[model samples]
Target: MPLDEESPVAQVRKNRSWEYAPFVNYGNGMGGDRSNYHFLSLGVEAGKVLTPTIHAGILSGQFQLAVNVMPFWQAYTPAPHTQTFVFQGVTYDEPVGGGTYTGASLTPVIFRWNFLTHSKRVQPWFQGAGGLIYTSHKFPPDVLVPHGTPGGTSVWNFSPQGGIGVHYFTRPRRSIDLGVNAVHISSASLGDHNPGVNASIQVQVGYTFWK
Candidate 1:
């Protein structure tokens, strides 16, 4: 059946001023390879709607734009994984540690592509966000060896992330969000080392305000 054209969710056209998104991120353990490096993120977003919701392509309400300021808190442990190597015609075994760590980040831009329909209660979105993160301690030496400084990691790292999520609305212009995200942390070659750590799959829950 066709949905009500006048439903608040259907009629929303990016007419709102700002949105607040508060979310939590659960790391997926870097595709199941590493377990000790899994991190959890508590985050929030504030942004201005840049475009009206557009019905285009295979997904309705798929095209939307917003500029956001995002802040996050993250915590993790650095459990070392074992690595075997051949050096000087001999086999060597080593422990590659992830190390215990805590950090925070501030992202300047967050772009969301939302899939919308006439459904007034549910919306789906894909997102990418980038910015800087600061840690209380340097990253694990293993993470910095190949790409970064051999013995130490940087406290200031470049952060990049992507994810998918869905929002369920209980009332007009408000929603509860759930999703997962993957994140990478490194100094991007500017901080002496570039060894990077890939956080495991992240779980997220948040609330959104569309006004």
Candidate 2:
């Protein structure tokens, strides 16, 4: 049968060669940093299916290896100011770094499993990925006692995340993607104090081109 003869959604799942997506994501801190932290990013995703379809029933899917690169990444934080802390009976004044922090990020490895939905319009998937972040200033700012001192965080940090998503094919070789990811940021002791964003719930929307 000719490739064009198949349904649009099937074109994406049946031994497809490549996928390219341009996506935007927004997230808010979920754990300790909830109320004060937010994130927004625009990025591109490129990858190829590395395996033939396998298994059966709910476990059936193809494996793909992809990378996501975000040149425009921003974190909205509390404005730079002094915060008071009391340890024991002593009152301490600490200067904090905040406001908008700009950076770039890259997720070099995304292990994605495209599930076999047996449907004509929707293909759901789950993926696990790890990435790197570089900001202009130390991230998740730490306290500085004397002001102008290093906040003891790092400009570079690691982001490990996982999520589930669906691709809705609007036409042959094209899809609109939606997903929700749980991401964790950590320095792995790359700095003196690693007050990373413990967890964040991110929502993503993208348009994909299939080949």
Query: Which candidate number would show the highest lDDT if scored against the true structure?
Result: 2
Clashing pairs in 2: none
Q: What's the TM-score of each model vs. the native?
A: 0.76, 0.92
* Each prediction's whole-model lDDT (CA): 0.65, 0.87
* lDDT per residue as tens, model 2, 101-148: 899999999999999777787889999999999998888777753656
* C-alpha lDDT of candidate 1 relative to the true structure: 0.65
Clashes of 2: 0
For residues 1-211, write the lDDT of model 1, one tens digit per residue. 3323345455344453466887776664564345555666677877665566566666655444444333555556545566676778999886565556677777776787777565677767888877787777665345335443334567788778788888787666777989777777778776555666666467778888877
Q: Flag regions of model 2 displaced more than 4 Å.
A: 1-5, 86-91, 145-150
**Model 1 error, position 53 (Å):** 3.7
lDDT of 2 at 32: 54
Judge candidate 2 against the unseen true structure and give its global Cα lDDT, from 0 to 1: 0.87
Backbone collision count in every prediction? Answer: 18, 0
Where is model 1 more than 4 Å wrong at Cα?
1-6, 14-17, 31-33, 60-72, 79-90, 93-98, 141-150
